[model samples]
Target: MRKIFFSGAVLTASLLLGACSSTDSPAPAPSARASHNAADATFAQQMIPHHQQALEMAKMVPSRSSNPKVVDLASRIDRAQDPEIRQMQGWLSAWGVAATSHSMPGGHEMSGDHSMTGMMSDADMKSLDAAKGPEFDRAWLEMMIKHHQGAVEMAKTELAQGADAGAKALAQRIIDAQQAEIAEMQGLLKQG
Candidate 1:
């Protein structure tokens, strides 16, 4: 009787330990996947082309604007935005979404939803393209300031409503960096 009771107690203890260990282990494969939703997708899809336009605008500075400070700011925008575009592209690919599917009639245009805020209309872009020298510098600074403000608003929206951890992190980063750049641009505008 004593031997049987001892064995039974040991077995119970082992089973309890095993159960606790299993519960403490990591989650299964399916639950471990990152969470994302429509907002994250929309943010990525809209931002990619928006960033592309910024790059286009930045590229214009080297050839058209002679101001060293304006050129440096444009270069900074180009460098920062290019990597972010690729990052969002990766996120879209991971989500099985097309990055360019949301464009408007023209290959370069954004959909109607993204047309407001920081986005430059086709005519606005054409005007920027046509500008040169101090005209180009002033126009670029003004447009980019508005663009950065738009980006901050979009990022704030994402931080508030987005489901994905990764997307929210990127949104926060964008808000911080773009806000700083906006302040910098405003200072540059004051000088002109």
Candidate 2:
């Protein structure tokens, strides 16, 4: 009787364990809290060229400016923005979107149908490209401050409307960093 009872108990335990086994279906992927959206795509598209222009301006510093502090600041800007440009580019690629936006009827890109905020006009860039020494330093600082301001504005818009977690975080970083640099530039301007 004891042997029979033990065998029955073992069989029951095995059946219970089999019933508790997990299903073969794969577990669902974790839901992303902040996913891509129109605003996120727009932000990346606008910011890429904006960062590129800043790099262009920074490159001009070494050859054109005499101020050590200004040159150093420009170097910092160039270093910081290069990676950010690549990052934005990666985002565009991952989303399967074009790096450049559709041109408006007037040859402009983006919704405004005019200029992107903080982008220097071709003429303005040309002027900076021509300047040298003190003039170059002054032009570089003033234009960059304006450029940074425009970036901050664009970033703020992203923060307000953007949906992607990564994009929104990047926007906030731009705002914080550029705003601090703007204040530093303003102080430098006051000194000279």
Candidate 3:
């Protein structure tokens, strides 16, 4: 029961945080929320780079991992994030904000850590790229758990502070999805 509740907490955290990040783009002005609240802007700016690193990390797994679980999770991460990146780009353009930096992760007091809270460091990525077989699978799972948690934290901030309806909704979705992924990653960790 305690585990169930903890999982619920993670879920709630994800709903609050995940729905907040937008690697896609800024909200377009013509879309009613043009004059986005400061929170919304911050969410987009921070999320773009946050998602980018996840993509970078996800791409590394296929070649490095031989395990089906690692491959499946990496594929899901890429599939989910690719469209989000495009969506965020569109939002930024419409909002009249320059999506600007593609080089770093989200960095607001909201998203906090740009590297998604140390989920994927330069060394982590480099190590994953170097690893093969089961070793790659283990490293990938460990890094992804942290990355997903970072997303949850950022989403919680958005749910708490963001005024834009769309941003809030997305933040909720992120909380749901990523928390589930965290569970999956944990299971993999136990197996390893």
User: Which candidate leads the pack in TM-score?
Assistant: 1
TM-scores of all models?
A: 0.81, 0.78, 0.74
Candidate models: Cα lDDT each: 0.84, 0.87, 0.76
* Candidate 3 C-alpha lDDT tens digits along 1-83: 99999999999998877767567765554663454677776777777677877888889887778888878988998999878
The true-structure Cα RMSD of candidate 3 reads 18.3
Which whole-number lDDT from 0 to 100 does residue 111 have in model 1? Answer: 35
Candidate 3 error regions (>4 Å): 1-35, 101-119
TM-score of 1: 0.81
lDDT of 2 by residue, 118-177 (tens): 988877888999999999999999999999999999999999998888899999999999
Question: What are the candidates' C-alpha RMSDs?
Answer: 4.1, 5.9, 18.3
Error of 1 at 78 (Å): 0.9
Candidates arranged by lDDT, highest first: 2, 1, 3
Question: What tens digits encode model 1's per-residue C-alpha lDDT throughout 1-192?
Answer: 999999999999999878767857654454212577888888888778778888989999999997899989889989999999999988888778777665577666573335556988777788999999989889989999888888888888898889988889999999999999999999988998
The deviation in Å at residue 16 for candidate 3 is 43
